[model samples]
Target: MERPVAVKTVAADLLALPDWRRTALARFEREAKAAARLDHANITAVYDAAITEDVCCLVMQLVDGTTLDNVIDCADDGRLSVLAAVSVAAQLSSGLSAAHAAGLVHRDLKPQNIMVDTSGLVKILDFCLVKVLSDTDPQLTITGETLGNVAYASPALLGGEKSLDGRSDLYAVGCLLHHMLTGRPPFHGEGPAELVTQHLTAPPPRLTDCGVDVPAGVQDLAHALLAKRPEDRPGSAADVYEALAPYLPAPAPAFATRRMPPEDPQRPFLVPHGPVMPR
Candidate 1:
């Protein structure tokens, strides 16, 4: 096909390291398989993947805007408005619900893997660390290495549970939401080791401590997601979406505001049966 597309190549730094090359290659392939299993509005579409002794790359739909991390970076007070944050959560959970139903776990769901297009539609990116729940293949991860971004990983992930499922991703959603509203992660440490230790032992901080004026229920939802135990978190992404659903913009064209962020996540949910945002 002759068209514009985004190409993901194995990181040059990893490629330069003989010790990391094998694992990086395996992860690149795993990402392709995991992403190919789902077709969702919020998940980035992977068109193709290929690897050999000499090359590795994935062709994906080219995202038109910025990473969620950048969005937070540029926002006032380094945080999104409550409505914008909730909107992002709703779309993200909707995508997660589909991935979970397909028996895949996005082991890495940090904000850096999320894209916010010009219309405010959210697109999940970088499935390099994805886990297929039903697959018996050995996970490409190296033991003793921090899994995913320690900042948003679940206790199960940071502490090395035998198995991880959708709840793990929900934990990341909690972290993302908290970051969106507070401009920082639920926990912090001097390094990966300390961060992992804190994830295993320390409780996630209350959203109120950040002085965010969200509703009581929203605060409770964030806490539920950050619960140290996956079982204590919301049952599934679908459930989380329901909790956040009420905050989505009404799907009425009449509700359009005079001014809104170009990357507003509310745009997708507000249109009257509009086409899905470009993958």
Candidate 2:
């Protein structure tokens, strides 16, 4: 048998706790397996998963490339190349299209969750935090707390509401695109609570303010994705892709370029650059 890729797995013991905790893990495994069953260029491939007495280890395909978050940090002037940003957006939308078709909502879609391999092949990762709509379990609720990474969460999600679907992920993708173009998320504040409030009430900072020449279509798409009401956003990931299709470069074969040089396996390629926004 082929040896597994050398990637660290989240230990089950570390995640050990009440049944509520395991519920999310179990959902992750189920959705990941479903995602793996689909053949797509933009979705991360799951190799194997084992639940031991103390931990669960999911062996996923090792993607060798920097994340969009890292790319944003190294951008020449706090802005990504328009072409590069569009390409990444296209790939992200494509991945979301597949996931939505399979009834999966990537509750967390952000720069950190997007991995761009050396050849510019973009794959969406970290489905451990995904929300599968068709599952029988009740939506995992944390009383007096919110779920998901605050920076990229949709306004509805940040508002402590439930019943979000693919449109929520679309909002996050819009936020990611905005960040790629401007090197920052749409809303920023002293802390998570403030940011969530901004998501719910504040108008997004204009992309033009970032000193980037973004096209009107791209701007409109961003606005639509970041719309406060989930119903106001694009209907689906495919719809988001369609809106941006005129701007996307031709689709090249997956891994079109030579493999990018590997980073130190011991270190995470993208480190959180700033303090976690307050809550």
Candidate 3:
């Protein structure tokens, strides 16, 4: 019997460019291996993967919901309510924590790559496709490889740093959080180069400046995550989760929510899924 699964195939165009083809193929293989090793509720599970010169495809768990891109687009003014936004960020942080625990980093994190299941659980997609292509022409390959995701790229990553860690991913989470609450990314640019310059030199935009009414602590947390140096950012994804936990809506009696349905992101936290299990 055939089962439902989400299949991700390497873009043929990527393989057509000699600068991207060779390194792209190898990165696909590494991503496959890394993804297969991770198992977490907030992360899309990888069941199988195959890589070759001509083909590279990954089969993943098929989630029953929409991408965060849709979630953002469908929200008021393209932004979630403060409570709902926190819930989504919390889940994303949880997924990041899991990947960090497994010694993996989700280098590319953006709304297009986040999923919100029907039950309101947020799942991080492509947790292991963190590898950016490196070819003979490094700058060209880097820019091409991270096209859509450069908005969330960390300062260190954009600065040509060879080493990356969980902190880098946290920077993207900051961008995510900012985007979710403000209807826009923390930094806006005319092109990739301008965005890179902002991420590298400009201080991250403050939530207060955006006219969004969020808690002071939450705003501070977002700014700290966008810190330039790795050590300056939150120590780990776990730290981020804890910081946002206070903002999660408290679970109400099941009866209370029957008449008034909970929001998309609150569904997973406000309602019980099953008998509680040991953590």
Of the candidates shown, which would achieve the greatest TM-score relative to the real structure? 1
Candidate 1 C-alpha lDDT tens digits along 1-279: 788899989878888898888778877887787788789989889898888877798989998889999999999989888888998999899999999999888878888899998877899888777787876665465777666888999899978875899999999999999999999998998998898888899888889987888988899999999998888999999999899877766786654543445676667767634544433
lDDT of 3 by residue, 1-279 (tens): 398998999889879999777767776777888778778899999998878656689999998889998989999889998888889989989888878877777878999899887667888887545643222334324543443377888988777675678898999999999999999999989998999999999998899999998998899999999899889888989899899988888876563335333227777767646232222
Candidate 1: list runs displaced more than 4 Å: 12-23, 255-260, 272-279
Error of 1 at 209 (Å): 2.6
| Candidate 3, residue 129: lDDT | 56
lDDT scores of the candidates, listed in order: 0.85, 0.72, 0.81
Q: Pull out the clashing pairs in model 3.
A: none
Residue 224 in candidate 3, Cα distance off native in Å? 0.7
Q: Comparing 1 and 2 by TM-score, which wins?
A: 1
RMSD of model 3 against the true structure: 4.4
How many clashing residue pairs are found in candidate 2? 5
From the highest lDDT down, the ranking of the candidates is 1, 3, 2
Report model 3's TM-score to 2 decimal places: 0.87
- How does each model score on TM-score? 0.90, 0.83, 0.87
How many clashing residue pairs appear in each of the predictions shown? 2, 5, 0
lDDT per residue (tens digit) for residues 111-189 in model 2 = 7888876545788887876666776565454466556789999887777656768988888888888888888888899
Superposed model 2: Cα runs more than 4 Å off: 3-8, 19-21, 250-279
